[model samples]
Target: MAADPAIRAIAALDDELRRGMYEFIRDARRPVTRDEAAAAVGISRKLAAFHLDKLVAAGVLHATFQRATGLRRVGRAPKVYEPTGGDIRVSLPPRQYDLLAGILLDAVLAAGADEGARDAAVRTARERGHEIGADHRRRTRPGRLGAERALTIATGLLESHGFAPARDSPRCVRLRNCPFHPLAERAPDTVCAINHAFLDGLLDGLDARSVTARLAPQAGECCVRLTATT
Candidate 1:
């Protein structure tokens, strides 16, 4: 599938220090010194300092200097750096698409095991899907929530299940991609069951109901469309 342009842009950052600094901040939690990052990545302190400065300029990291309290020292202390309160930095881990692809292919094989196997597999998938959706709904439910709140609740549910949700203007919640689309193409009913249970759990959690999802008929196509019904 062609990547979403936005996602592609994000992936493009992998070739630069932005990516490294992002990982540094994400892993370190606290701010780190240039020498620390340099040693960690086997780069020179000057190079690390240069890239760290760029990150600070990008508003992704913050800089602070602390002077030592030593009575004999006359020079200013070095700057200590840390991440700013902002976007959670992003970095791609080693691609594990093989594991995900294997699980999906296994779903297809499991469905083909017997005449009733498809339905059985779908039931299990639905239950698991619903369990995930229910958990996320509980976590993200707004205070004083109502049916109007189901939109956010349902989007969060789908996102938690590895579906990338996007808004098509205001009227539609377009599922940009599905991790299971390949398996779904072979087993539409199974996919539908999963979507139904997911939405059902999300809406139920928000004290809301009335959602519809339809699977598109091809691999890599959007398989879920969720929206408030009312």
Candidate 2:
């Protein structure tokens, strides 16, 4: 398996001097020169350059060239280092929560209608879910998808997509993981609506008769639940 880049990034601060330099650059909140970093950490300029470049290679920091703002010797612009300002996560077994966030964020940003961002997110999520279901019907199985078989298909597909769906009964599917996560907790009214709409669209696209998607909010679980209709 490929190595986690986050591990290497964290390891970049293993040394005391390197850790100090990283903390100084991060707290500086501006492009910091190598000399500034060295003075702050009480290290030699040459040593600071070495540690800063190491941090760059490990993706903990980024370097750029900019001229000093005040009067100084006229020469090539000095290189400066800054924090990349990106999150570094190392979840066990990996996760794609960011991907889900990106999709919803895009939907929200693209929403220009007076109806609002929540409405747009729900609409976009349903459309996306429908596309997934329809593609599966087209590429995998062409027969009419009855509720039971449709649920089976959906569970497998959603699991692969990080929903962590569980078969609570022969008829109901409970999603244990909401990739939307803290965002869902922060705005259940909006995010739950999107989840419900998405699953509803998934069933509709599957042509799975007699199945219903509903809001079944529970702590430590997804807001949407699916069941075979009576």
Candidate 3:
């Protein structure tokens, strides 16, 4: 059987030396070379290189070749290690605490000046959805979008974002699942408001004059529904 990618990635850091090296590289403002990693972990350069390569293979770190100094040198540029943007977590039945933490952090930051966190989240979510819609328009070049075409584009966007949209009728699309899920259950008002605003902004950005986003929350379904206007 194939090893789970997340498990393999996490197992790479099981070793004390590799874990220490990973922490050092992650905490550093800049990438670290094999030599620096070796010095930090009190290991030989060859051993450090082996462990670092393993980390790279497991997707725990990213490797880039760059000259240490600004000036180009005769020898090959040193290999540097940095933490990968991706994260690895192993959980049975899948819980996403990180996602919750991120949302909470955003809300806290937005509340710094006594502003409403839900309002801030809704604004941010809408802006992001608008950006996605604008990008989709630019890529597909769907000129002078009509109601049908706009619904098609919106459905495609929703599917890409894991919304599982189903066309209930010519005038309505029902989402089969809530991408935000349990978190939405935990904070219905905040999550649903943000979700509604996001879809609203998306339709606006797509210039879908004939369709509107409405909050029609139902059990086991998404909080927002896309409805075609007359």
Candidate 4:
């Protein structure tokens, strides 16, 4: 199997010269040319170009050819490099702490009260889950979802969120992975509550009337489980 693209991209920065050049281009107010990057890292222009191209291939930098002042020049314009606009992350088993932190911070800012932050976070999580459920329902057009249909939709949605849901029975699904992970371990009550409410909202929005979100905490499993009501 091939190496993960993200891991390869991150590993490319391990070289001393390449790391220096990357930082120079990233902090530059404008895109940098091969000459400027070479001087910044004390390397030859040819060597700088070689490393820069490697970075580009790794998706760490973007390359473009343009005149220094964005005007037409008599000679061929210099190739400029800049940091890629998006972030690159690599994690085995895939924990998304950045996403969780953003949600919490957004809730805190929106609520503007310390006491209400948790409540806000729960509401935000539920609303997001509801929107996802509603969107999935619209796209799939599975009208009046029965227990099996609801399980299928639920499993897909959970899997997309990194829950690793598996069907335990026709009426119950077991989630093997927790996207929140250690945070859930550190703050079980709050995190578990938010997860429950989120799943509840998802079921509601999905119109999976035969299913209900229930807290059935088990070792090495998600805090909430979806079960058939009848």
Best by TM-score: 4
Ten contiguous residues with the weakest lDDT in model 3 = 92-101
Candidate lDDT (C-alpha), each: 0.58, 0.83, 0.83, 0.86
| Local accuracy of candidate 1 as per-residue lDDT tens digits, 1-230 | 65443354355444566577667766887757777777777789998888777766656567887653554656765776776665433323112233344434556666644536445545445544455556655676555544445566667756544567776645457776655555556766765565555445444545555554544433454566766565
Ranking by TM-score: 4, 3, 2, 1
Top candidate (lDDT): 4
lDDT of 2: 0.83
**Model 1 residue 201 CA deviation in Å:** 3.6
Supply every candidate's count of residue pairs whose N, Cα or C atoms clash at under 3 angstroms: 1, 0, 0, 0
CA deviation > 4 Å runs, candidate 4: 1-5, 70-72, 109-117, 138-149, 169-171, 228-230
Show the lowest summed lDDT stretch of 10 residues, model 2.
91-100
TM-score of each: 0.45, 0.58, 0.59, 0.78
List the candidate numbers ranked by lDDT, top first: 4, 3, 2, 1
lDDT at residue 50 of model 2 (Cα atoms): 93
User: Candidate 1 vs candidate 3: which has greater lDDT?
Assistant: 3
Model 1 TM-score is 0.45
- Residue lDDT tens for model 3, 1-230: 77778899989999999999999999896889999999998999999999999999999999999887677687888899999977787764344455335545666666547567776777767766777788888888888877788898899888756688999998899987777778788989888887888788888888788899999999988899998888
